[model samples]
Target: MIEAISTETTKFRHATVGRTGTALLGIGIALLAAVMPLAAQSGDPRMLDKLGEAGERSWDGLLSGAAQITGAGGLLGFGVVLGWMFGREFVDGTITGLFGLPVSRAQIAAAKLIVYLAWAVLVSALIVGALIVGGLALGLGLPPTDTAGGLARQFALGVMTALVALPVAWVATVGRSVLIGVVGAIGLVIAAQVATIGGAGGWFTVAAPALWALSEGDDVSGLQLALLAPLLILVVGVTLHAWRTLQLNR
Candidate 1:
């Protein structure tokens, strides 16, 4: 099982490398978005506040642009990569090769999920790296003032967001196409935003953890975790369903 998983994960590494064009686009968008704020707010005390002070002096345009690039572009890229990871095996009939192995199909599905998630984290790091480089280039300072602990917390939140997003793996596996998964993920995001604005509580908040995490900026708190928990549960449940699907085929 372990060997099978390692082999599956290596395929995704190759996929990520081969799909560098799309990955580079996401990185470039994030870099430009994060830096544009520094250009607009040069020499202003307001720039120092970063996420604070959103009045007339606010770098609203840059902030909005950053959100758009990271949220929209990043999500799209994630969905496509996930789709490819899950879809290619079926497309090329390599899934049967895995079934011929000693490993259980459930293990195969779980391995693919893990591979998809690792890809998500790696891609996210690339995007964040782009943001850091862009910020430094624009003289916006390295790391948030909250320093070690705060940065750690934010990084945790970001990873949580990415991990919770693995339900898209279910979508990719079931849909068998990256395009459908991308559209479905985007639609879910839009729906979650509407639910949040309408004051609909409960599991709806978990529906869009990444959007909330990014929108709240540095406001990481226990409350956000409370809201995000259900979404994580949903990912786990969906993963089980995907595993079950594989097992039944055996």
Candidate 2:
């Protein structure tokens, strides 16, 4: 029994290390791309040249460059990476091997959740850092004042972005298929975007972290907090669901 638990724990740790490596790779790419925008935009330019005549237009190179550099949709990219990590286990039949072990299903699930949360935090930090640095280089300027409130909002953005993984993890465990889980995560992000466009109520923000980041400003209102409440609820639900699913087989 002790050996079984140790083996399962080791597998979980191994999967986490692999995912961390991928997260670092993404960060490295972001770092390299960060310098491209500054170099492209550092030239003498007539602000009022003919509408079409341009030496180095913002749209031509820097805008797209900044987008890629910032890794704006990086959380979604991490979701795909996480899905692939679990998918490997399924492909190698290691998931089945785990079930045959003496560890409680809950322990197995909890281990995965720990890895998931760690991945989310690490990737979110990388993406946020990239965005801040890229934004400064592109002349957006540092966030105003960097006050406590500003810092809080910034930290919240990272946390909310990371929260996305809870649902992804839940879907992965329940479906037992990485492909389905990844597709589901992509669908959820799309649906959140649509909900914002359609003027849906705050409920949409329950699962959408980007919503909070996009909404933050000097004039942010109480209604914004109301919106975040549901997102908190959604996070709790996903965490509970994952726990229950793991406990079932135990």
- lDDT: which candidate is best? 1
What lDDT score belongs to each candidate, Candidate 1 first? 0.56, 0.51
lDDT of 2 by residue, 83-174 (tens): 65445555565666655666755565555555655655665555546645655665656645533343344445555555554466656656
Score every model by TM-score: 0.70, 0.61
Q: Every model's Cα RMSD, please?
A: 5.4, 6.9
Which pairs of residues collide in model 2? 206-231
Clash pairs, candidate 1, are none
> Across residues 1-250, which tens digit of lDDT does each residue of candidate 1 receive?
6886798867765664436734664376555676555454565665555534221122333334454445445545555555566667666677667667787766777787776666566655665566556555655566555433433333443455456456667776676656666666676556656765665522454334444444554433456557666766676677557655663253
| Best of the candidates, TM-score | 1
